[model samples]
Target: MTIKSLGNPYDGDVDLRHGLACNCSDCADDAGHRMKAVSARDQRTRMSTDDMLDRAVESAIVRSMFGHNELSRRSFAKMLGGTTLAAALASVLPIDKVKAAILDEIGTPEKTDLSVGFVPITCATPIIMAEPLGFYQRYGLNVEVVKTAGWAVARDKSLNGEYDASHMLTPMPLAITLGAGSTATPFLMPAVENINGQAIVLHNDHRDKHEDVSTWRGLTFGVPFEYSMHNFLLRYYVAEAGLDPDRDIQIRVVPPPEMVANLRAGNIDGFLSPDPFNQRAVWEEIGFIHILTKDIWEGHPCCAFACSQAFAETYPNTYGNLLKAIIDATQYASDSANRSEIAEAIAPTNYLNQPVPVIEQVLTGRFADGLGNVRDEPNRIDFDPFPWHSMGVWILTQMKRWGYIEGDIDYAAVAEQVYLAADCGKVMADLGLEVPAETYKSHVIMGKTFDPAEPEAYVESFAIRRT
Candidate 1:
């Protein structure tokens, strides 16, 4: 619903394209007059329904469009199931006006300490390698990398002010916004940690003999962790296999590293892992790659660098510099030669805790399906200077889908706070990175064809039942 329907949530007119937001009603009155020129009657009568839908929804439809709200993104987005931008705008177009609402950015602070923490995960590799490679220091930071276990612990240290920043999940930062996880303190929106370095490894126990067990049917598999990106991807994959994740297959929890061991012994089927370990699963020949997590989501998101909302506001320069260093590291990692160095470094005791070759095989984005299947894709991981707040919005929808939150909320508002676009912009301008027209990452979810233009519709089109 629009703000006016909710008692004029704000007064002025909030023009997204104009980059000026007036929460007051007077602006809404003004906007009503302006939008009158662009109507359905003016549209070409010959336009097909698909074109209309595309023009109406556009890519923003699939993006996580949100604003400030009392309701958590998870709850708010779920309530708007099948809610179109047109319908959402209808609720706010005071006196029958069509308007756009682009979320506003939160304030930022000055400089901060350069020291940051790291955990032994594939996603954290860039953070670690960048330190020793002089990426952070070159960007004016005396970079420090701390080692830890588990995402929660890493996030806590980053939030508690123990470390300036850390490598984390794309959803982890969003969960922080919703006050999910084991913390009363909330995390601000992330600058995206990593993209597409994850894989799902199944245990041999389910299939026993790794025979061309390509499809999911009677065979059962383990999910490892719930609410984590891997778990969601796993569910999407199983459902696409024509098997009910909750019924058709046995789903259980196992650590990313433990997946390979369990698969070898016959305790559970394949599980999910990020980098070196996923590469380990293949090298060890423990189990066949049933479905790569990156393949399921394709150009999907993985990790992010995040901090508490308070931290970003108090130390803007520090935050900006930190982001600058990471962006530099991202450019370094994107370079093919530096990637090999990253794989070799993380494959050791500090990161993935596996062999360099294993890490290299997976991080390089080329994989063999043990049974003569191979895939090599470029642009899987990105570090562009785009002001895309879509990641923050999409994650909120995922959280709401599984009943993690319950209430009506303002998605655009909440998402705006997390993106830290203005802060990112200050640094992007200084660093010379150009923001994208509309940031969009390719997505391939199991049986679901991700339609960025009408994501809600595509997701609703599923023949399978919704949970």
Candidate 2:
């Protein structure tokens, strides 16, 4: 039987969950209710996607009006008849408008004033510049972008609700969701803030050992966090060079703001870190850019805009507005014409706390590589807000490869849950920006192609994995 063949709830024949089984007392007494039971799969196939969404919206509203008491709702529906109750409610409340608002997420925000955390680095360009550039204000939000010391603080604040949202590394949300580094709080990454905006920097003292990775055996490195692309990519880069990252080298978790200082103090030999720290090292004449992470993996995801699942559900409209603001700012930062302007906006002490020239060189992609010659790479750091699901799967594979996460991971399910690609696509389409037709695609890293389909094989293919 199809849903269309079933009696409408509005007509007071409310048996949405009941089937034609004769054991039930209600079904046994009702002679006319002996029709074949409609399977859940059949009901789903009979309804269009839009129809399902509309029904869900309607159901939520009805449940909310009855204080989510199923017994009260069913009794009220029986007493007043669903049509009469719906009409009476619609007369008093803007039912259709409310439904549209919920469906499109165009309603006014639940909470306007919010605190968002960020590390003062170029990876947080979109999240930081959005405040100065009026993107948040455009969406009717008063956001305070807090300067955090590091990723750990950001993760803690986000988990504890001290931050309504935060700027996080790409792998952070995945790790947070999996409870790898922190308590498993379901996190959502709706938009990636920047891509290809990181590099490996060696102390200027290592200039003689630059061209060769095999020569570097007992060096120490600093990445912002364990669950960061910096750590994973650094490990991948060195593992390919016949060096076990865990044993051959010592990696310490140093915050982005402290990375340059550590390199200056000789605490760490080099770092695979986010800009403007990497750029700042060159600015301080302490380190040289060994290789842009773009050279490792072109268009790799770096930092992202993230919040908890509870926050997104509790303040959906607010979350929607925030995401729109982020995506808007990200697209604005993507344009090369606006790079210098953005550099000036986010370079102040309250933002990146760096010299304008330093930030300008990183944003404009034209700067000295700290080795005497100047280079121009326009895609050195670019902003694209799309959170590709394949990117999540790749991070998960790295986590599994290094034994950060243990056995039996459903890679695609976890990626889909945390990445929120469908929600991002909706926002991108609303903004009239180009959205990718598919979220899962193949990625090539360091001359190796990573297939999201065969993740276990990909992990097993690595000879240096902890697993």
| Residue 299 accuracy (lDDT) in model 1 | 57
lDDT of 2 by residue, 274-379 (tens): 9988888998899999999999999999999999999999999889989998998898899989888788767666677788899999999998999997999999
How large is the C-alpha RMSD of every model relative to the true structure? 22.2, 19.0
Candidate 1 per-residue lDDT over residues 188-259, each given as its tens digit: 644665677676665534444444433555554554345467766666655565656666666666655566
Candidate 1: regions farther than 4 A off:
1-115, 204-225, 372-387, 439-467
Error of 1 at 159 (Å): 4.0
lDDT of 1 at 227: 48
Off by over 4 Å in 2: 1-105
| TM-score, cand. 1 | 0.66
Clashing pairs in 2: none
- For model 1, give the 10-residue run with minimal summed lDDT: 1-10
The prediction achieving the highest lDDT against the true structure is: 2
Least lDDT summed over 10 consecutive residues: which range in candidate 2?
Answer: 1-10
